[model samples]
Target: MDTTMSADTVVLLTGGTSGIGRVAAERLAATGATVVAVGRDRERGRAVAEEATAESAGTVAFRRVDLADRSAVRDLAAAVDDEYGRLDALVHNAGLASATRRETADGVESTFAVNHLAPYLLTHDLIGALADTPGARVVVTASSVHRRGSLDFDDLGFSSGYDALDAYARSKLANVAFTLELAERLRASDRADGVVANCVHPGFVPSTGLYRDVSRRAKLLTRLAGLVPGVGTSAAKAARRLVEVTAAPEYGERTGLYVGGDGPEEPSEAARDPETRDRLWRVSADLVGVDPDWP
Candidate 1:
């Protein structure tokens, strides 16, 4: 909790305009780390950046990027590389929960594209920047719902029988698998020393806009469910957890790990499978048009 980062340290955080990402951005900025907040809404992004800058000791900048668009994500990475030659942390927290199945311009499912592939591609594109920085970290916002999810490589996009919860859960599962595979690859690549990747389940946060696209009934149900004891945590608390994983010295050497409210916990059986992780990596790379053997 007392971890202090240098002012020169650069953090690229998606979904920083709102919810847990916003809180994390503010908290990290207070630690004197330069925070680059990415989001689709330029207005909100600018407002959050101003607020964070006013309240924090470090600098906070905003960047616009549509996570669902591969080209846009690539452009965002390019811009980040151009501005900051090295990155200290890459936090992926942007995601959506849709009531109905939808496809992106890339012809991939909207939920999968936004939640999983976007982070995969963005991380793949920024690996060099991260590798060059010592002790760089990758923190993915995943979910415990992954425990109830299953992946079918044959139909990863969920072209048929698309259930909202099932799609969201699968995407979360992919988040875990991606983290595991990314940790392994970073170890094998150049400048792997001190570079680590980990995922966190922020618990059920019903107050965020993540479920805005879901039906009213579903939204009501989630709000009701969140009222139960031990069911949900406030967005600020969840964001603090992310800040801990991102800046805490204790987790600096941890990789391919899953951390929840109680600390590091075991992911689902599928999330622990090497073969599944490899397959998911390859498929994700293919979907996003990135090289699987990226450095």
Candidate 2:
């Protein structure tokens, strides 16, 4: 942990109350940073903050939020900036999987709304704060399953057919594409030297609550998979991977990288395609009603 960096830094981490995110919160705070942890569960969020305060050189603060709501997302961004003024890292660790298709309060698909659109809009609203902080980063918790995803803009909501795993994979693909595009934009902008964006694949972590909304059979199968030898990722290990990307020096300069346990590597063909990345960024901005061009 970079105690000096952590002591001077401010990190906004969503889904900080659970799974790898929960562990990462404590770890990040231990590095001596003021970590603002966001999640819907007030108790868990507070508990994380309390634990981090007790165990680490740094500290954590909890905020309750429903990322599915656009207004709430905007308000959260506003509050973060109003309080912190500058942001060292914006970590999108929050995500979900749904067995059946549903729409958010904003009428966007629930899975896409929470996993992709929420972060997209939040980033747009916070890029200025990030640019003000030297060596700031945007760390997205993408997944390796993105290779199996199809980003069909016409069917983004999966109205034609919906599968929990497929929807989750697609959302992660969007995360990767968004990171790639955002990195390019940040690099070309006046704030290019300060802000960097990257995504990480934490591997198959069936131990997390991410699959809580999946079908019963899927849940049972996930549990069974967890019992298998070396099949499931431990929350502790995954959180370390997240911590590495969030605070490690190597990532401070690198942008558009998809980091995994092995380190930075190329992502799926679809994710690497400039056409797909640009289209996703533009479409995401339209869905969130933000300007396509940004830092």
Candidate 3:
């Protein structure tokens, strides 16, 4: 994955301070793009920025943000829009997994709030900025596990029961649905010159910290799986997959692709349904207090 971004390009990447995201941030920065790495840990975020800047000799700025807070997501978008004026790429790589059922400050499920709604609201706020830049792309980090998931608009919070793996998969399913829907809407928009939106299943990355919040049994399984020669995707490999989707020519030429282990592949049947996509868009908009009709 020796992909490169053009000089002066600006990319806003969520979850950029750690794990696969951190490596992706460095890789993007190495391409000469101003990579804005958003995360919750200020110290860790700043450290990554400093180290990546030193290693890549490129800019890697850090922004502390709690994606579960709707207000914070809004503020982050506003700040990025004001500072950059135009965004070349927006990557929704931040995700959440909780061992127990938890609600965010916005009264939404933690996993759903961070994994899905944050991207939904942030994209709503930044769509104008994205539209400002011709050829801008939106790449989301989804998972293949979404095939095992189902969405119940009435029960997005999983009020009936809670399982860490199940919740994560559900949120990932939303990621795919949102990416596909956004791409379609962008196509019809008059301003949709070259903006593309796609999601990639980064494969089963057992080595990433994404599963640290899962239950003991799940964590143990991930650890054991990581021991396999090639069962679990390394953070660096996963980052490469992310960068390919973000800056690759093929991805820019197309829209609404779901790339998994074998490059572009069909997502779950539920995710490809137009009705499901529309409903997810509307419900997500309602959840985040935004109008469903968007660019």
lDDT of 1: 0.91
For candidate 3, list the clashing residue pairs, or say none: none
* Candidate 2 global Cα RMSD: 1.3
Q: Once all C-alphas are superposed, what RMSD does model 1 give against the true structure?
A: 1.1
- Candidate 3, residues 193-295, lDDT tens digits: the string is 5689999988778867788788899888889988898788788888889999998777877899999878999999999999999999999999999999998
Instruction: Give Cα distance to truth, residue 101, candidate 1, Å.
Output: 1.0
Q: Kindly provide the TM-score of model 1 when superposed on the true structure, using C-alpha atoms.
A: 0.97
* Clash count per candidate: 0, 1, 0
Q: Give the Å shift of residue 153 in candidate 3.
A: 1.4
Q: Write the per-residue lDDT of candidate 2 for residues 60-95, one digit (tens) a residue.
A: 999999999999999999999999898999999999
Q: State each model's CA lDDT, in order.
A: 0.91, 0.90, 0.90
User: How do the predictions measure up, each by TM-score?
Assistant: 0.97, 0.97, 0.97
